[model samples]
Target: MPASPREEDVLTARELYRFYRAGEEETLALRGVSLRVRRGETVAVVGPSGSGKSTLLGCLAGLDEPSGGEVRVDGVRISHRPETERARLRALHIGVLLQTRNLLPHLSVRDNVRLPQRAAGRKPVTSARELLAQVGLGERMDALPRQLSGGELARAGLAVSLANSPAVLLADEPTGELDGETERMVLAMLRDRAAQGCAVLIVTHSAEVVRSADRVIALEDGRTTAATAPAGGAVPAEVSDATG
Candidate 1:
């Protein structure tokens, strides 16, 4: 069954704008992008490269301060919080999977998965073994990053992202490094998280990812000008039997 939406949204953004200043010019990455993700909802943000998909994720995750507008996560306005507070809140409540697998080269997969818990000043509640198993990395828990295949490393990163059982999961190009089958597996895991009541948002260019979402929001030239729900009008299935 689909999880119920929380009375309060898990994530809300209003008129968000981000701009980078060069010596004599400014580049607008996001312009007036407003979005909301209710608890138990899965939203996919899609656009071509440089369309500000990643930038939107960063702003939503509180990794970057927006040049203008408001962003609230878990009902708190994190966009204006102090850096330390933002970092602390993120550690406690947000799970982020970036395009790059930013694992520590010296740490084994198990250790890397537990790092987030340690950073949050909490003992790891979710067993690394269990998480690795969920990601199909149970046998590779002791493997170092260099010894793992690209897909294995990606799964490890995902397991680490779920370390806190966060209220929100933010993934950017999560399946970019995986093969077709692995990508399906990863998306299924994400769908399971949303089914379990986490607000899941993925920023990707993949058609498969978009189709898996409850809603698809498209960005063009730094603005969200298109938003659509699936034609069937039923909630997305947990897993699609079809393949890319």
Candidate 2:
């Protein structure tokens, strides 16, 4: 069956199209978009408002269904699957950090980072404390989400996102709320994740993120404006700047 998708490709979207319909009215959000993010590579999706960035991410992450097209993660097709099945696959292979931080208010930072794996009945690929340390939240692991500042909250959310050590790391505007210094730190952590063999897909409008990515894909009016990447190339290593 077409050899399934290559396991090395952590995320894939083929001819993706989406439309929202309401009482005979339709809004096209994406049109025939296709891309792949390979293991250890970082790809940036950059576009203006209403350019289908978020919609495209949703489809790729198995969070939304496309009117037409398919999405696969690590060789398994996740598109059009049952929501429960999608959620299971996401817990096992996908890490998402959208605009709203996905942190539990009641849980301590360490527990929040451990929640995903625990919910899935799987051991964490990395320890909560070590992962938090990597994201510069080592000391804040005992604190609640409400006790964290904006930057700290972002860091905590990021730690939680990596709890299961997902194969495909999808981030939307991860540095949007951070100061310049904190932004640099977060970006550096993402790069480090890429270095460790995670396929990093980031939807962002930041010039810094675009330049840091190994490839850049731009969308305009629900279509691809540009995509630049070397075929089958491995992303290079990067230094972490998370040291406080």
User: What's the lDDT for candidate 1?
Assistant: 0.83
lDDT on C-alpha atoms for all candidate structures = 0.83, 0.82
On a 0 to 1 TM-score scale, where does candidate 2 land against the true structure?
0.88
lDDT of 1 by residue, 1-244 (tens): 1133246589888889999999989999999998889899999887766889889999998899999987877877889788888888888889999768558899999998888888788866678889999888999999999998877878888898998889999998888767887888889989999999999999876668877888888888899867778545542332232331
lDDT of 2 by residue, 1-244 (tens): 1324576877888889999989999999999988888899999887777999999999988899999989988888889989999988988989998657589788999988888877667877789989999888888889998898988888887887788889999998887667777778788988998999999999887666766888978888888877765244432222122221
Per-structure clash totals for the candidates? 0, 0
After superposing candidate 1 on the true structure, give the runs of residues whose Cα lies further than 4 Å from its correct spot: 1-8, 231-244
- Scored by lDDT, model 2 comes in at 0.82
Model 1 residue pairs with clashes: none
Find the 10 residues in a row with the least total lDDT in model 2: 235-244
